[model samples]
Target: MDDLFARQDVIKRLLNESRRWAFVGLGDNPEREVHTQARLLQRRGKTIVPVHPSAATVLGEKGYAALADVPGQIDVVGVYRRAEHAGAVVDEAIAAGAGAVWLPLDVIDEAAARRAQEAGLDVVMNRCPAVEWALRR
Candidate 1:
C-alpha cells in the first residue's frame, strides 16, 4: 500500500504543482475536515472548487454540483467522501479529465485508485493533503 497509495513522489508532485483542486463532499459545513483541509490548501495558494449537491460557495470559491459540471481544466479532484463513496468520485474525476484524484486520509479504495491510475491520472489515497504539504514544506 505504501508503494502504491503513499508514493511520496506522486504526493509531492500533486501538492506542489496542482493548482485547481475540486473537493468532492465539500459543502457549507465548516465542521467537516474537508472544509478545514480545503482552507489549508487554499491558504497555500491553491484554487479550491467546492463540489457537492448543494453547489454552495465554499472558501469564497464557486461550487459545482458535479465533476462534469466544473468547467475548464481541473488539476486535481479531492475525494473527501467516505471510503464507500470514493470509488464513484474517482471514476467521475477520470471522466472529467482531472489530472489527479486525491482520496484523503481514511478514504481507501484500491480498485478505484488503480482505475484512476489506468486512466492516466495520478492517484493519492489514504493520505491527508495538509499533512503531506506540511511534511513536504
Candidate 2:
C-alpha cells in the first residue's frame, strides 16, 4: 500500500469537505457494505448517487448506469467492486472528473490509485468512509 493511502489529513479532507459521492457497484442489496456505507453518508448530509448496471434506485437516490451518465458534478467516487475490478472503476472515475476516488477497506489497487492521483484526483484506497468519519468525531 502507498503511504498516501493512510494519510489522516487526506481522509479528513475527503470526509469533511466532499458533499456528493457516486457509489459505483452500489446495488439494492441491503446486506452489502456499499449499501450500508451509502446510507451512512446520506445520514451525514452528503448526497449519494448510485451507479450500477441495473440503475435501480437505492436509498431513494436516482441511479445511473455509468459514472458518465450522471448529470452533475461528483465530489467522490466510492468503489465497492472487488479488487480485481476496482481498476476499471477508478478509470471511469477519472474520466468522470471526480474530485476523489475512494476504495473501501479490503479493496487495494496501488496502480489504479497512482493513476487516479496522476489525474489530480485524491485517492483513498483500503479505507472505509464510515470508519474515517467516525474517527473524526
Candidate 3:
C-alpha cells in the first residue's frame, strides 16, 4: 500500500484547501454518518454535493444520482459506501476530475486509493473529515 494515507501534510492540505466535496452514497437520513459529515463540511463553509441513486436533496443542497450528474468541479469525492463499492465511486470521481478522494472512517480500499492517486487525485482513506478537522483545532 502507498504511504499517501499516512501523510499528514496531504490530509491537512485536502481538508484545508478543498472547498467542494461530493459525498457519494450520501442519503437523506440524518442518522447516517454521511449526513453528519456532510453537515459538518457545510458548517465549515465547504460546498457539499450529495450523490446517491435516489438523488434526494440532502442538507439543503441538491443531490445528484451520480458523480457525473454533478455539474462543475468537485474538490473532493467523499466515499460513504462499503469498501467493495468504493472503487467504482473513486473511478467516477476521477472521471469527474475531482481534486481528491476521501474514504471515511472504517472504509478501506487500498487498490482504489492507489488508483485515485495514480490518476493524479489526492487520496485519504480510513479517516473521518470531522475528526481530522477537530484535531486541527
Candidate 4:
C-alpha cells in the first residue's frame, strides 16, 4: 500500500479543522455512501456542499453542478466518484483552489493526488472520511 494516500496527520487535521466540504457525487439519494459520509461530517458541524449533476439540495445543503460552481472558500473537496473518474474531480478541486482533496475509500488516483499535492493541496486518498473521523476519537 502506498503511504502517499494514507496520511494520518492530514486526515486528522482535515477532519478536525476544515469546516466546509464539497462532496462531489453527493446527490439526493441517501443510499449512496457519499451521502452517508457527507452526513456524518455534517452531523459533526461541518457544512456540506453537494456537487452532483442533479444540483439538488442534499442533507439541507445547497448543491452545485461542479466544483467551480461552488461559491466561497471550499476547505475540502470529497471525491466520491469511481476510481476512473476521480482524477477529473481532483483536477477540478485543484482548479477550484480548495485547501484539500479527499478521495474516499475505493477511490484512488495517484496521479491526481500527486497533482493536487503539487498544487499545494492536502491529500488523503483511498480512505473513508467517516472511518478516519471515528478513528481520531
Candidate 5:
C-alpha cells in the first residue's frame, strides 16, 4: 500500500466524518469485536449498516446480506471477516464506490489495500475504528 493508502488524515476522516459505515461480517453476536465496534461507532453518531448473510438486525439497525444490496451510498466499509476473506470485501467496497475501506485488527491484505488505494478509496488495515475513535475523540 502507498503512503496515501494508509494516511492517518484520510483514515481519521473516514473514522470521523463518514456517516454511513457498512460493516461487512457484522452479526448479531454481541461478543464479537465487530458488534462492539459497531456499537462504539454508533455511539459516536455514525450510521452502522450491518452486512451479514444472517440478515439479523444489530444495535437497532436493519441488516443487509451484501454491500451492493444497500440502497444508499456508503461512506466507509468496515471489514470484520478473516484475513483471507477481507480482500473480497475490499473489492466489493471498491465496486460499491465507497469512500474508504477499513480492515479491522488482524485482518490484513496488502494487495487488497493496494487495490482499494488504486481505486481512489482510502484504506485502513489492521486497525480498529473504535480504538481510533478513542484516540481521536
Candidate 6:
C-alpha cells in the first residue's frame, strides 16, 4: 500500500506524458466520474478514449467496447470499474501495450496493481488523475 502511494512521480509522469488514455467503464453519463475525469483530461490536453460495453459516444468522442478494440496506441488505461473487475482491465491494458494503468479512487486491487507494475506499467491506484493535475498546478 505504501509503495504504491510512494510512487507519486510515476503517476505524475503517466498522467503528464501519456498521450492517449483509454477510460474503461466510461459512458455518456455526465454524472459519472469517468465522464468528469475524461473531460478534465481533455481539458488538460490529454486525448481521451472512452471505453464502454455500450460503445456509446461520450463528450463528442467515439467510444470503444474494450481496450483491444481501440484503434491506436493507448498510453494509459484509466480504470473506472469495481475493485474486483479491475484485474481483468489491468490484464487487458497490458495486452493492449499500454504504458501505464491507473485505477482511480475506490478501485483498489493490490494484486492487480502489482501485476501491472510487474508488467512494466506505471500503476496508480486509488488516485484521481484530475485531482493530481490540480495539485500539480
Clashing pairs in 6: none
lDDT of 3 by residue, 1-137 (tens): 45567478988998888899999989899999899999999999999999999999999999999999999999999999998898898999999999999998878899888899899999888888988899999
Per-model TM against the reference: 0.97, 0.97, 0.96, 0.97, 0.94, 0.95
The CA lDDT at 136 in model 2 is 86
Each model's total of backbone clashes: 0, 0, 0, 0, 0, 0
Instruction: Output the TM-score of candidate 5.
Output: 0.94
Error of 5 at 38 (Å): 0.2
- Computed on alpha carbons, the lDDT of every model, listed in order, comes to 0.93, 0.93, 0.91, 0.92, 0.88, 0.88
What candidate 6 gets wrong by more than 4 Å, as runs, is none
Worst window of 10 by summed lDDT in candidate 5: 1-10
Tens-place lDDT per residue, model 4, 72-111, is 9999999999999999999999999999999988888899
In candidate 2, what are the lDDT values of residues 5-116, reduced to their tens digit? 7688889998989999999999899999999999999998999999999999999999999999998899999999999999999999999999999999999999999999
Q: What is the C-alpha RMSD of each candidate to the true structure, in Å?
A: 0.8, 0.8, 1.1, 0.8, 1.5, 1.1
lDDT: worst 10-residue window of model 1: 1-10
**Tens-digit lDDT track of model 6 for 50-92:** 9999999988889999998999789889999999999999999
> CA lDDT of 81 in candidate 2?
96
Error of 4 at 137 (Å): 1.2
Score candidate 1 by lDDT. Answer: 0.93
Candidate 4's displacement at residue 60, Å, is 0.9
TM-score winner between candidates 3 and 4: 4
lDDT value, residue 123 of candidate 4: 94
Question: Which residue pairs come into collision in candidate 3?
Answer: none
